[model samples]
Target: MSDTTQAPAATGSTPASGRPAPRFPLPALIVMACTTFIGIVTETMPAGLLPQIAGGLRVSDGSAGQLVSAYAVGAVLGAIPAVMLTRGARRKPLLCLGLLGFLLANTATALAPDLPVALAVRFVAGAFSGLLWGMLAGYAIRITAPERAGRALAIAMTGIPLALAAGTPLGTWLGTTVGWRWAFAGTALFTAAILAGALIVVPDAPGQHAHTRIPLRKVLRIPGLATILAVVFGWLLAHNLLYTYIAPYLRQEHLDLTPDVALVIFGVAAIGGVWITGTLVDRMLRRLTLASLGLFIVAGVILLAAHGSTPLAILAIILWGLAFGGSATQLQTAAGAATGEHADAAISMVTTAFNLAIFAAGAVGAIIVDGVGAKSLPAVMTILAAVALIGVGFGRRAAFRTGR
Candidate 1:
């Protein structure tokens, strides 16, 4: 975390000793992107298949929701250890191992005959997902030039929102048409593809610092890192509170919409948001963060007002998706910039905070739904969105003072 320990500068076409540090090749970037895509698909596919899974397992819909919550819990717990244990390991092998774990876990889930087994398998899948995402962010940064780091990170991260846009709808369709098991099986296949791609594409560039000597305390003490973590946690909590309930809420309101339709809309809007924001991120990350937060506030308000009207509700959701997608890249970029040399730790902390928010939001949303019904969701989201705006304001002020 010390400026003195900054990564060795890239000399003219080579390191100082004349050996070339590996360049960020397109194939390697593709491999890392696939890894992120697989992890996200595995984590989010269950959201679209929850009803089918619940029916198959002989449980209420709310009970099946626990499967999603359980996965998040696993992610929150797994992130830090995954980074610490694998620190300085080669990127290709780490990615391969992570995808292999995901493949096995999803395969187990696909074959499991009972809800308990399915939940446990999902937990395992989430652990690997957390590891993959945390490592991928740092790996992507190392492969790209400093000026283009934000863009590179966004490209790698496009997997997650893309999964939501395409993978979720595909999983939902497969589940409804064939069976939920097929959805899991398909995820396993995607995992396999990601593993194969990673093994072929990513180069092994070990950090110059002694792998065993990461200064944890120094990393934690970095300026603005802790504040960014707090903002990310709040932002995620607000988003997931509504996200976890979106499909169910629509169904309960008798909107005459299928899970596939909902997912398709959500995914499309999310993908569009991610694509547009990725282009703008390098030029205006801070401004985009503020704008995205403002959009989130508007989306939450619209969600509150349009809950009963099907067309209006759907429109609101698309706006929500756009806001959510844009916010993700901004948060990750902000966290990475704050951590500098310890980007891996920064990413891990953000992943951990993000998942913890998911679990908390899901649990809290369920309680709200059960107690006060869907009508309360908007009020909850509004409060969280307001807090996130406040956090962003504070962040901007702090950055201005520090000339960051």
Candidate 2:
């Protein structure tokens, strides 16, 4: 769908020039990118439409927040099993099946009439989302040149920020203008397009290894794997604690912004951040990771100062978005580097940690918001950001020791 296609190379083959080798067909990359875009959009739409959904379903705002949490929980639980179950499956078929599952789950969300059903559907949607993302990362790496793997991954991940920047706003507008159901209906449509694109473009690619499958436990035992997981867990926990509650916090503060306006601002800032960070990640992975963590801390401080100032708060959020946009990519790269041969398992573990962070953040933010009021949002976020920074310090030490 996007006019981006680089020629594919042989799968799992080393570069002939003793450099990074290209692994998959260019068309397959495009298909995977499209699927990634739809996956992100489906995953994040609920964040933008929380208030409307809460009102429509007659649930507490906290209960409505569970829609986001449920998906994160499902993703945390689903990634490993999916990877293990489909260990040696062809990439194209797995991609197709994952997207198909996502399509069905989103459709279920669109048609659900009750809160429980909606939450359940969101969880299923999340499960599919995890499988799709995990597979995409591994598939991209397997199909691309070693030197180009970072760029390829960046290209694939571009879908996430694009979905956040463009898709979320569109979904929010649709939710406000039509109904929240239409937002999910839109996701289903996009997923269908991605599915079609995959069918038309992706070639049948073989598995990365014929007989070498790393056990999950062995994968987890990589030197810095546990530390990296801790760092990502902390980073995401802090980021989502603020992010998941942002829309509702802004509303409760009686800020002079509508839901659509806020969502647009968030989407734009997030995309800008992702674009900048994506490029940086391809070059200076570790340096950028440290820089992003610092920026996140600064964003939290700025948010604290901009507590009641709408324009200032918007500016702060944009910075926060930029910081967070690079976070997962940075951590994913770190995990891959740490577990050189077990890239698939490393990817799965990182995915799991990320989802768990989302679930933890949402649950914690809800309690904080209910007990402390919206004005306390920045302070809470600031504290979490500080914690993330501390984790980064540990990550830096671990990286230094491991020579990463």
Candidate 3:
């Protein structure tokens, strides 16, 4: 398709000689960001309110915890098929449908009468989460100019750190104070507003042409796609290994700290990381990615060597969050750039890899905590971070190319 085919409203088309492109589409981008915020807050708030959820559903805490697991599993299973099936649909309508699906699922979860029913709805919510995530990279790219794709993606993902840092905590507090059901309902209301905003402001884009569409198998064969995905898996695996079990890791260190306090520091630092990445990603994608992974290793080393020093532990957590904050943007941009027209398919793969890492981290981290103990988590994270670093270094010519 020619430049004329790009969505007139959304496209950050290059301006005439000596003229600047239009300003960033902040309103549209914020709508997308809010979608992410709702998805994450819905998925994680259950964790913070597990006690309430358990009592309400008449289930054990262990069983209640599976609400999170069910969601992750659904995401892993949902992204690929959803993206493949919807590849030819109009962008805005498809996004709206995904939002509606997610909203209903979350509402169902809030009203579920038993553990089985809650788990089922949570799974459905996760499936919708996968659908939304699968589209984000391609959506960001489609809505912006090439030079601004990375920055656009960074903005679209702004919801993540905020959701992790503040949204979940606040939702948890609300659930505990009023009831778990209200928490989900509150997010549902927010989702409704975002959906309306998306309908009003987000531009419509035509799906891939029939002649240009390729099968998922071939998309996977695209050069650099696999390497980018490998990096995604390794890098996130290392992060989740520590993140999923952060409380245990903190307790094992015997530092005078709470997980909430540590995570707040991490989340706040992550905001800085996001700003730095958005500023330089278009120019230094490769350099920034490598630096992030390297810093991840350095953070692990600090934790390994610091013993129980509270100050050092807090510092390490900050570094760790900073390393992770831009990860989704960097990796998704690489995948989209690598595949070009197949960006949607490549992004679906990236999404799947990310959720797989989440599942793996929980399962594998448990084994380590049971067998070697939480102290060993950092050592393992360091090793995996090095592996991810090597992947990025080697992938430079293919996936992590130097420029936008």
Candidate 4:
């Protein structure tokens, strides 16, 4: 990509290299964060409002749940091509385009009269989300100085956990208290505000020089890229296995915790995780990755042994949140660093893997809930965490290399 560094005199931040750094770009970063927040809230708020949505759409709750799946499907389908085709577009304008699409889709979703229309608009919303996520990290990197890339990315990705911690819950409350349609309308309003911010506040960054863009096949061959994606897949699969069915998991005969209470605890802990990760990720990328994976294993084991102990279950949820909260920053940072100039392509793959895991978790968790039961989730999550941990451990030379 052609260099598009913001003015170094704005923020006056400095790197360890003793050079003047570009502006910190806090407004732009926050806009990006809010963009992610809207995307996630749009994608996930349906889960919490299924009963209302089903009633309004005149479908069974199971059918309403397919709205979420439709979004995931759109994301998995759109991420790669959307990114690849737009590799040469100016970053800020492309982002505005995505935000506009999201605004329209959410607005349509809020007014749809039937399940089919709602699902189609939801799919469109997801496609725009995939486009934004695929582009966000690379844009953050382009606008920041090289030495401060990790911190910049950490800031850009803060929206992910924040979406889980605050946005989705608020949307759910708004949906239930007012109407489910209002939740989506609120998202559309937020997107409009963000779109305006992108046009006015975010600096334009040039896309990759046409000659520099990598073909999909060659991008796939980037060393360590596959390994990092493997971790993304397995770790998220494990997380969603429990997260997607947390209500049922909490409702298990032995557990005393309510889903609301458990999620509150998890969300708070996840915010802490993001804080810790933002503080340390630039210096200890590999260590942080290892520690997060290890914590996931510990959380799963604790859940397995919790029996009827409410405290134990709470502890497990806290650990799980801490482990998962900063995952996008950690993995996306690694993927961007690993792919060098081709980070957009790799991050698109990360987006694809992320949505695929979300889709798979719903299906897999459903089967587990029906056959072996919700209690089996912790054990399944533990096995997957172990596998990801091992992948990170062995992938050090390429995927999770030290000396960040």
TM for every model, in the order presented, reads 0.85, 0.83, 0.95, 0.94
Q: For model 3, state the Cα shift of residue 271 in Å.
A: 1.3
Candidate 2 per-residue C-alpha lDDT over 1-404 given as tens digits, one digit per residue, 9 for 90 to 100: 01011223544555457765544366676676677778777777787788888988888887887887788778878888887667678888988898899889998888888899988988887788777767777777676655556666766776776776677778878998999988888889888888898889776666547467777888787777888788878887887776667777777766776655665576677666666765655456666776787887787787777756888777777788777776666677677666665666778888888888877886788888889876676777677667766655676544312122
On a 0 to 100 scale, what is the lDDT of residue 155 in model 3?
Answer: 87
Candidate 4 error regions (>4 Å):
1-19
lDDT against the true structure, each candidate: 0.75, 0.73, 0.86, 0.88
- For 1-404, candidate 4 gives per-residue lDDT tens digits of 11121223435666668876666788999899888888888888999999999999999999999998899889999999999999999999999999999999999999999999988888888888889999999999899776567777878888877888888899999999999999899899999999999999999999989989878989989999999999999999999999989888888846888887788788888888888887777667888899999998999999999987899999999999998888988899888878888999999999999988887898899999999999899999999999999998987777888653
Q: Cα-based RMSD of the predictions, in order?
A: 4.4, 5.2, 3.7, 3.5
lDDT for predicted candidate 1 compared with the true structure: 0.75
Over 294-324, each residue of candidate 1 has an lDDT whose tens digit, in order, gives 8888877876777568787788778877888
Identify the candidate with maximal lDDT. 4
Better of 1 and 3 by TM-score: 3
Candidate 4 has an lDDT of 0.88
